[model samples]
Target: MEHTRFARFGMVCTVDHLASTAGLSMLDQGGSAADAAIAANAVLAVTAPHACGLGGDLFALVHEGGGAPQALNASGRSGSGADPGRLRAEGHDRMPFQRDIRSVPVPGCADGWMALHARYGRLPLAELFAPAIRYADEGFPASPLLAPAAAVLPGVDAALAPGDLIRRPGVARTLETLAADGRDGFYLGEFGKGLLALGRDGAAGGSGEGEYTEADLERVNADWVEPLRARAFGHDVWTIPPNSQGYLLLLALAIADRLDLPRDPSDPLWAHLLAEAARAAGHDRPDVLFEGASVDGVLASAAERRATIDPSRRARLRDLTSSGDTTYLCAVDSEGMGVSLIQSNAAGFGSMLFEPATGINLHNRGIGFSLVPGHPAEYGPGRRPPHTLAPALVTRPDGSLRAVLGTMGGDSQPQILLQVVARLLASGESPGQAIGAPRWRVGPGLTGFDAWSEPDEASLDVEQGAGWTEGLQERGHPVRGLPYGGAFGYAHLIDVRPDGVLAGAADPRALISSAAGR
Candidate 1:
């Protein structure tokens, strides 16, 4: 197990060491938690482009000292020219898959940074972005995690080796522009032109047209909304509301909270119950999470579902789907401010629609939209796709911040978060112990199209050494052994003790993830 880093002043935990260092530097420079999180995320954009970048969506849960936590939904909407009808006529039944330009949405990462900075930042934009710009322009050593993924991008050397020095001049220039001109530097400037050009060139494979007008780009803004809350393990859990699959985490937790979960982490029955709860949440998500749907009813139904879980046999769901490539990080300042942030490109290299002018790899978030008419996530103009980026925060009953945590696992995100949170709260595990524990995910398949495609039954993917493996198998779970390191999600967490001490941990699944503070 990884050792937890403890600090009295501040803490920053992220999936990459360089990014974690960048965030720590921000905190040392007297920046707030928001500034630290944005700095870390910017570095991730430069270092881990396959998972997140300027061409992505972001969601966050922010909590200030003695104040209620707030949620930021910075996911972008589908273009005004989106057309589900044309896709249907072309014989498509679901959303377009990744790699197609039509699957790209208006990126909301830049706007998210701006919104976060506007509300809680103490440093200038240029200062917050300096580390990423320097790394992009002067070159940084390629990480083992990034080498193979970067090789797949256009123009990248296929034989790229870990530690090789790599530079992105165009991306550097774009970051410089963003630092100098704020959000306008991206959505209304040269970067925006390059995006429009790609659409006009009909680079959307054989699809009709990839139309993204200035309106779609210009109208992109982050919204600050009330976080959805659920009481579990004597603490209140908060997450980004609908449009984000975060509610799944809450739903699963609610069901588990109502059930007589075993306190032993090694208990096979515990993992089985959690997996069943996850399957139930995944099965019901599509039916309850569309635009204007009442999540209260769904959350209220958790108790009803809790009674159906059979300890002796796995509860099977009719259908389920899950997938994603993303990054999650957390930062905490001396003043009791915490930020749980998540960002993603939807899949590896996103839509793979790299814009030459800006060095931006556009995201395939639009792929989350459905093609079925009248569906909540149906492809349409000015609609935000159902997103998997779910960041979460927890507080004591008296409203004191307790923890800031999250992970990146696409549809498996909530399941991963559930494991970590349950360990941290219900089992009283330390941050390091909780984050380093073996994890399980409920999904249709392990990889490829089948991984994200809707399937008749869901499988439970458990880490190879999990003590409950045989138990889960005997309980009728479709148990699949996942090799340790990289198969599961990379989670980062900051546990706030009642004494104001911060304890943080970064998952070992990521090659260079770290937790640092001073």
Candidate 2:
């Protein structure tokens, strides 16, 4: 692939091959950490177009040198036509959410990167996306990941084109303009017209969707939000601003802190521990959250009171679709910078309404909008959906990056991320060992486990690539094991040693990469 033409590194790590090469090239050019991140994100919009794209949402937590970590939210907003009252009259209240055309929000992924660039980027936006721009204009081989998506849609290949030189020319051109002009160029220009035009013809029924006019896109702006944080073990754990499931990570970490990571996440007993934690933590989504809630500020303030233990129950309930199997990435650069980015289309394919114009798939976030009247996150004029895309970052004492990390798989994300953090910091594992380690996912309820190891319920441990499928089976949780590097929500990690050298690890299960420097 043209995007993979080369690789260089002062310090960088990424989830896609082309993305890594793009970022590494920036680092080699002496670009700052933010520049490399912007570069990597552009490539992801290209190659990993399945789960993420330029027309999507993005969340990042950045820590530059000795500075406190700052967050960036590039999530899209709703249109004026949306109305919460209309949705509730139709009766649709559940999570693990559903997929509908109404879920598509104005994409903020590109703008979000642009926002990050403006504050910390050293190179021009055009330079940051040069590789991706060339690939989109010139072309590159279709990645294996895109094959199924291609086949699923009739005429998607021809509509979007296929073969070695596959490219999203439309989105590429849109990105080119955004790179030159910043966030406004995309949301306010021809790009906005195209997005609105496409979304209007979509198949979902919700407000802010079905009929957004050019007036709406031209007038709408991406809002900047103060991300939420919760103190854990004396360290500050920062995550996405309100309207996202970030609290789940804080809840999971707190729950895990109660249990124990000193043992394996694959143990039968460990499975129960994780399941209980997930069940306990996941229940908060449907009942507690609403549109007006100040999820961020209040979460920490209410941490003492709101942080309730199901004193009687052993676990909590989790919604599957609203927070399901997903994808995530994390990285830190040579400048002592850290980034945690998580993007998704809601479901495996989102609205599954592939835009023939840009190869950009829309999000099913509207599925998360409540059908209940007076609900906070209901489909309405300018309301954000309850999101599962929360990426977490932790800073160690003395002002250095401790862990730059995140995971895929909805509710399972916080579950996996918390355990890995503990494994790396508490268990004394190296970054590689910590991330490459075997993983497990807690379930939606307090019933049986969704364990990937022994199902015997008595056996309590399994190793990586171990006959974990068998272990999970014997342990009573139907487990689907893959060839070692399975979809365990691989977390791209960079462990910042005291001297500042980074020991990096990209989940081998997924196509991830990393490089470090002094």
Best-fitting candidate, scored by lDDT: 1
| Over 4 Å off, model 2 | 1-9, 84-100, 152-163, 202-210, 219-224, 260-271, 290-292, 295-327, 444-487, 512-518
Summing lDDT over every window of 10 consecutive residues in candidate 2, give the lowest-scoring window: 1-10
Candidate 2 local lDDT, 429-476, one digit each (tens): 676777777765543222111221121222222334643455345535
- Report the Cα lDDT for residue 207, model 2: 45
Which lDDT tens digits does candidate 1 get at residues 21-126?
9999999999999999999999999988878999999999999975579899999887777788888997888767765667787899999999999999999989
**Residue 441: error of model 2 in Å?**
1.1
- The lDDT of model 2 is 0.60
Residue clash pairs of candidate 1: none
- TM-scores for candidates 1 onward, in order: 0.96, 0.81
Candidate 1 ranges beyond 4 A from true positions: 206-210, 319-323, 444-456
Error of 1 at 114 (Å): 0.4
Clashes of each: 0, 29
> Quick one: best TM-score, which candidate?
1
